[model samples]
Target: MRMAKIGLLLDEQAAVDKWAKQENVFAFYIREVLDHLGIPYQNLSKETASLEEIDLLITGLLNESQQALTQLLSFVEEGGTVIHLSDSPKLANWTGYKSVCGGAGYGYTPKELGHRKPVRFLKTNHWYNGEPAGWNAKSGFLVSGSPAGQILSELWTVIQAGNGKIVHCQADIPYSIVGIQQGVEPILHDGEPAPDGTAGIDDGLLKADDGFTLDWSIDRAATETGMKYFSEAHADKWREVLVHKLAELALEKGLTVPFVGRWPEGIEHIATISHDSDFNLEESADITLSLLKECGVYSTWCMIEPGYERPLYERIKQEGHELAFHYNALEAEGGLWSESEFKRQLQDLKSKADLKTVYTNKNHYTRFEGWGELFEWCEKEGIQVDQSRGPSKKGNIGFLFGTCLPYYPIAWHTENNRQYDILELGFLTQDLDHHALADTSVIDPFLEEVKRIGGVAHFLFHQLHFLEQPKVSEAFRKLVKAARANKFEFWTSKQISIWERARRKVKIEGVSASGEPNVSGAVSGANTVIWVPVPKKADLAAEAAEVRYGHLCLKKILSHKQAQTS
Candidate 1:
């Protein structure tokens, strides 16, 4: 009952029922979180010999196989790890979760902590009345001036059974993350207000920020360091809980887990600065470009219709910056949200480019209508990355889409809700300057969380705001400095897109406990990261090249001969 890596007891039917049966879609978050965490896993739903070679088994959604359940119980009795998600009536005694309905269904939240509890959040953050606008960078970093309380909803029960352990979750964490990341009733949302500056739920115009559950009035929170941040992205932290538990349980069996680093070159974190060239703000391009040059990093320029003049565009490209599209759907700007309209602006922006190639797009005002329409348009436009899913209002910033890192949106139209080809590079805030939320206090804490989870910290600055607005320019400078403080290297969206697409090609072979992966296809030599997870930080001190996301350690693994030399 115990030999190989973690066995993901998947339920194929769950995907089919995701749209009809709300309970089934809860399983979606588990696979998503596992993928994002970069954990080593084997799917047991289809084409598996037996669980005999598996040490830890995570049962997601419904299980129709009773023989597997009997084997699972026996394995647990024999000291194998079994983690039951959603609700499991048979696992009640081991999980310590009481029946919610007069000894019938499983519980929602844990009544009390179990014997073998995992570490809870180090700091509790919340949203209430917070720091007001006009608080400049010099004002302070920590935004704890406001009163708050606990905002996260995850609760767990862990019990030391037989020779192993049983971990249970009653709140349905995966479902929550999926709901937050995707949306609860985005497609059906109509009456919801445009509080985030995006369209209302009923607007029928699907912007990337559609169906957001994080309330601007309540969900915004600061880091434990005191810097303000979007409390919405806390889902990433919740997902990380599984990463720790996986490694902790595996270590008890004297095994180590391997994972891929979020970035190459052994870097702990990444940052991206983008400028939306609204109405071709060429007048402010020099100042914005100069600021980027002073920071010693390239950026992405998302251009709207009638882009910068050929000369300025040439300079931007010559400087090695990425030139992308900023699709305009604002009616006042004489824009439309139709597919034909999107294609029109895309073609127009591409024509304005020197290279005639646009790989990325961040919609004008982050306009989105449906779940898959924007992604589908991007796919058709040959765009590989998009930054449209973010908050336009200052208060609505920070992981509003439930992640700061780039991810492929799950295509709900598909039977399996398949991941799309385009990468969604969700930005934290647009126009961090603007002379209003002029403070850079939120930068560090956001970076701290990004570093902790191996995620990207992306910021958007409109070119026009860099010059006329003195505080806006100053805010940009402070942001770049704060990024440097966190040791986060700045990259353009193009670089991120290329790296992500390339990173997926890297394959890990030889899946035994020895756990040395025969990796290949790392295009960026010396920069590609291959991570290994040990129980302790000191596990691979001398040989370990770099530490990465989750408990995974070890360093950059060279996949080719050139990589070894470079």
Candidate 2:
């Protein structure tokens, strides 16, 4: 049997960021765990291929790719399985959909939809191995003309295109939709498992003719009640459900899923630290760097040049560290330094030290109104990467809040009515800059939100924050530990080499499709050529010394020549 290929269609940026914030939660952690288990999966985007190559498709309502939906139906036709989950069944308009609302809190509060009730699995004379049913007296009603209604109304659909099966669950209930492809007789009534390994007539388990059974017996009432009364417990259950379901899905699909890997599991974690200046704060930098180095991690330090201690920057570079400009242009009263000045500053820093990369974090939450200028400068100067996209507002001057994940920046030229000169490497994510230390626990929740949306967790930290207090250090250490324990791979800005290589390959392969300018050749030439700075010296030599006898003989010859001339 060939290994199954599972494709998850989600909002990639949102998912990744969400996962990072909630790394302590099981759902966030399981993403890494599943990847460690080697699940073959990829995030579905506009560029993904057809469903013929995929065996399973797991999607949520938030995943709004029409291409994905079309491919999902095709995969099902190819004898594949589709699992759909959402707060409302109204979202999924695909075929073979049956929704059952109202679960006994199920560890989630069912709002405007209805009241909480116990969810049960029922066996029906249909292709589905198990059908989910809920009993909520308040609003346990089913849609009359919806997908669920169609499935419940028709015994089966003529297997056209392919032998595909879809299992749709409404209201986030627990149930498995496997074994429908195999020919089996469906049980007519709902049943429950016996107390001592026996079967009893209850409304939870469903049996089929071929010894295939669907079990929905995970007890969650206690968890639900706990969540209702205690806030933390509820949060815990939410995480637990997400993690357990993801794991179960991985197992059911029989594929190794990665939480953070190349191609699919995108950018994992981003570290933030302060830069040097008159306010250089050496003690803080020392402590933070020491702890990170001890843990074998290299983080990006956003230094404010001129204010930064040049010696410290040199040391950081020597230690194989990365440096990004913490632009305090406003503080420096640089009066919105021109793009040329910015390029000159960056080049000067590179010349002074063996620096390889740069990121920018403006002082006092400063943002450049015209990012095109900054991006153009970066491209022209071969500054391959940047991450100056923050202050936590919904949007930057013109960019989106979460739009910094290593994409090629598009520059439009108005005169020619065309676009040109894209950046090789772009910003990823930025930290929520409004909070202070210890109060930074909000980072976790923010990371969780990023993970859910498939965004990178770029955290910004000040050296001063961690230096004064061990508590901050401890908190950061715990965060790192949790991230690692959950399988998040640590990377510095330099490691973006992996992303660049992959991106270049993709760009080269689909130049036309990307519609970006073809300046690779020019960029490559500039990077390869070397220029020597020092001038060459002219040769000069002194006459060699001679022995006394040799000197006497030379004088005699010179006298004879002078007499002949006279």
Q: Point to the candidate with the largest TM-score.
A: 1
Give all candidate RMSDs, comma-separated: 8.6, 25.4
Give candidate 1's TM-score: 0.79
Which ten-residue region of model 2 has the weakest summed lDDT? 549-558
lDDT of 2 by residue, 87-195 (tens): 2233333444334433122222222212123222222212222433423322122222322332231211122336766544433321211111111122344433334
C-alpha lDDT values of all predictions: 0.63, 0.37
- Candidate 2: which stretches are off by over 4 Å? 1-278, 307-310, 354-366, 392-400, 412-438, 450-455, 469-471, 503-566
* TM-score of every prediction relative to native: 0.79, 0.41
